[model samples]
Target: MEQLLLNVVTLVTFDGAVNWTVGFLTTVAIFAILALALNIQWSVGILNFGVAAFFMVGAYVSAVLTLPAPEGLESYVAGWGLPIPVGWLFAMVAGAVLAILLGIPTLRLRDDFLAIATIGVAAILRSIANSVEGLVNRSRGLNGVDGFLEDQVQGGDYRWVELAIALVVLLAVYWLVSRATASPWGRTLRAIRDNEDTAKASGKNTVKFRMGAFMLGAMLMGLAGAIYAHRSGTISPLTFSDLLGTFFVWTMLIVGGSGNHRGALLGAVVVGFFWFGTPLIQESLPDWLGSRVFQVRQLLIGLLIVVFLLWRPQGLLAERDRVSRFVTRGPDDRTRGGDQGSVWERLRSAVSR
Candidate 1:
C-alpha cells in the first residue's frame, strides 16, 4: 500500500511538470510569433504600437467565427461556427486590412508621431471592444472557445498537441520572415530603415515598403492571437492589455535583436521565462510582495528592459550583417582565409576571438 501510494504521488508530480512545461512552451511560441511580427515592421522602420489592437482583433474575430450562435446570457455579433482554419485565415485578412487602413495615414509620419498614432488606435479599439455590448459580448468576452484538436484529444494530452501546432506555426512564420529579410526587397527595406532619405534618393518607394512590412507584421500578430485564443480557451478585454500585448512584445524584440529574426525568438524565450516563471516564485516571497504579484511581474519586466538598454541594448543576439550572396564576397573570395563556414560559424568565431 505504501509503495503504491508513493508511485501514485510520483506520477501525479511528473504529470504536473509535463503540463506546466507544455503550457510554458506554447506561450513562448505564441510570443515568438508576435515578436517576429514586430521585427518585420521594425526592420523596415515602421513604428507599430498597435500590436495589441491587431491581436485583439484576431482573437475576437476567430472566437466569434468559430463559436456557435449564442444561446442564452451570451450575445455577440456573428458566431458563424466556421472551421478553425477558416477563422485563422479570416483573422489574418482582418488584421491586414486594419493595418493597411491605419498605415496609409500614419506611415508618413515621423517615428514618434507614428507610435503615438498607433497606440491611440489601440486604445480606441480597446474601448470599442470593452464598451460595445453587442461586439464580442463586451466585458464578459467569448468563453467556451475550443482548443486546437480539443475534440480529438482530451486531458493533458491535448496541451501537447496544441504545443506542437503552435511550434509548427512559429517555425513556418520564422522561415517566411527569414527568407524575406534575405532577399533584395529586404535589403531595400533595411536601407530605408537605416536612412529613409538615402533610400528615397536611391529611387525606392519608402512608403510602399513600409506599408508592406506593416501589413505583414499585423497578419502575423493576428495569427498569433488566434493561436493564443485557442490555447487559453477564452479571451477578454483584460487579456490584450498594453503591458501584455504591446510593451512586452516590444521588449522581446528589443532584447532579442530588433533587425534579426533569430533575436526575436531568443528574446521571446528569455522574457517568457520571467513572464511565466514569476507566479511560481511568488509563493516564496514575503506576504507584502506576494500580495502584489501583478505589480511585481511588471517591475521585474521593466527592470529587465532598463538593464538591457543600459548595458546591452543590441540584445543577446545582434542583427546579422545584411549582405547579398551574389554581390558580397566571402573571406576566401576576398583574402583566401579558407572557408568561414556558415553565418553561425562566423558569428561564433568572431565572439571567441
Candidate 2:
C-alpha cells in the first residue's frame, strides 16, 4: 500500500508538470503572435492602442462561422458550421476590413490623438457586440468552440497538440512578415516611419503604406484571436479584459526587442511564463491577501515593464540599425595576402610578427 501510494503521487506530479509546460508554450505561442502583429504597426510608427477590437472581432467571427449552432442559439445570429480554415480565413478578412475602416478616418491623426481614436474605435465595436442580440449572441459569449484538429487534440486532454498547432501558426506568420519587412515596399515604409515629410517629398505614399501596415498587423492579431477562441473552447468579454490585454502585449513587444520579429517571440516566451505563473504562486499566499492577488500580479508585471523602460529601453535584444552583407565576399574581396581565411587571420599573422 505504501509503494502504491508513492507511485500514484509521482504520476500526479508528472502529469501536473506536463500540463504546466503545455500551458506555458500555448501562452507563449498566442502572445508571440499578438506581439508580432503589434510590432508591424508599432515599428512603422503607428500607435494602435485598440488592438483588442481586432482580437474580439476575430474571435467572434471564427466562433460564429465554425461552431455548430448551440441548441438555444437557433434564434440567435447563428453559426454556419463551416470548416475551421474557412472561419480563420474570414476572421483575417474581417480584421483587415476593420483596420481599413478605422485607418481611413483616424490614421491621419498622429501620436496621442491616434491612440485615443483607436481606443474609441475599440469601445464602439465592443459596445455593438454587446448591445446587438443578432451579433455575438448579444455578449452571452460563445461556447463549445471547436479546435482546428479536434480529433488529433483529443478534446484538449493532450495539450501538446494544441501547442504544436499554435507554434506552427506562429512560425508561418514570422516567415511571411519577415519577407514583407525585407522587401522594397518595406524599406519605403521604414523611410516614412523615420520621417513622414521626407518620405512624402521623395514620392512615397505615406498614408497608403501606414494603412497597409495597420491592416497587416490587424490580420495577424485576428489570427491570434481565432487561435485563442478555438484553443480555449470559448471566448467572451472577460478574455479581452479592457486595458489588461493591450498592456501585456505591448509590454511583451517592448521588453523583447520592439523592431524584430524574433524579439517579439522572445518577449512573449519570457514575459508570458511570468504572467501565467503569478496566479499559481498566489494560491500559496495568506487568505487575507488572496482577494488582491490579481492586483498584486498586475503590480509586479507593471513594475517590470517600468524597470525595463528606464534601464534597458532597448530590451534584451536590440534591433539592428542596418542590414549587413558579409557573404558576398569573393577571392578578390580577400585581403592582399591572397585568400587568407579572413581579415582576422591576416591580423593575427601581423600581430605574431
Residue 297, candidate 1: how far off, in angstroms?
A: 2.5
lDDT of each residue in 142-234, candidate 2, tens digit only: 778888778665653756778888999999999988998888877887888788899999998888999999999999989988988888886
The parts of candidate 1 lying over 4 Å away from their true place are 1-12, 326-353
lDDT of 1 by residue, 1-353 (tens): 01101122233487766666777888889989999999999998788887899898888889899999997888899888899988899889989998988888778877777788889888998888889878788888789889767898868588778889999999999999988988888888999988889999999989999999999999999999998888787888888888889999989988776788887998899888777766666667899998898797888788878877887676766664544556455534534323456656644653464
Q: By TM-score, how accurate is candidate 2?
A: 0.85
Among the numbered candidates, top TM-score falls to 1
Separate clash counts for every candidate: 0, 0
Q: What is the TM-score (0 to 1) of candidate 1?
A: 0.88
Cα error of candidate 2 at position 112, Å: 2.5
